[model samples]
Target: MKAIHLKTLTTIAAAMVLSASFPSYAAEDMSKMDMKTPMPDASAVTEGMVKKIDKDAGKITIKHGPISNLQMPGMTMVFHAADPAMLDQVKEGDKVKFHVEKMNGALTITNIEATTK
Candidate 1:
């Protein structure tokens, strides 16, 4: 009985020491904890031409180059706008740089800018 009690205490102390060596993110502010996907860098932006825009549907169709962040090949596809006003920033046939990510099970354009080329 004495040996069993000593071993249990030693195991508890070891666990406590191991746990202290790691930082705890759970104690941080929940609001600051962004569980969403990380924002892509400027280099991750894909060049594309706007093929269509439907403000009412809040969607944009783009014929874009390979998206490195997504590991997606160059293709034309419809994407949801993170903000409906994003659709107003470009018209059909405009050349643009954009960032896209999967959000809520849908492909969404998080950032977009019109380009002269």
Candidate 2:
């Protein structure tokens, strides 16, 4: 009967140790929690108004919505054009839908289209 009591104690001790270890891991995870907004997906697109166009610099400034791919908030920022010919297709005050991505370590508009509304 003493051996049975010892076995029960050993089982309880092992379970206690295993469960105790998990709480520490959980607590550690809690301590390193992320308290920021969810990140945007990589293939997201944004709508923007063309603010400026600089063909000579191969850049265009747009007041755009959140660029999910870049995690950037809506603001006026200059983005390098992937193709300079794109400049001819857009002008200031135009509403456009554009896809932005990191290219050569710069924010670049990979594809853009002028919206009719």
How many pairs of residues collide in each model?
Answer: 0, 0
TM-score of each: 0.65, 0.61
Which residues of candidate 2, in runs, are more than 4 Å off? 1-43
Query: Mind giving the per-residue lDDT tens digits that candidate 2 earns over 1-117?
Result: 335688899999999999988755477777798743232343687999999999999999999989877788999999998888888888888998888889889998877778953
Q: How would you encode candidate 1's per-residue C-alpha lDDT over 47-96 as one tens digit per residue?
A: 99999999999999999999988899999999999988878879999999
Reference-based TM-score, model 2? 0.61
Model 2: lDDT of residue 44: 85
> The CA-based lDDT of model 2 is what?
0.83
When summed lDDT is taken over every stretch of 10 residues in candidate 1, the lowest stretch is 30-39
Instruction: Tell me the whole-model lDDT of each prediction, alpha carbons only.
Output: 0.89, 0.83
List of clashing residue pairs for candidate 1 = none
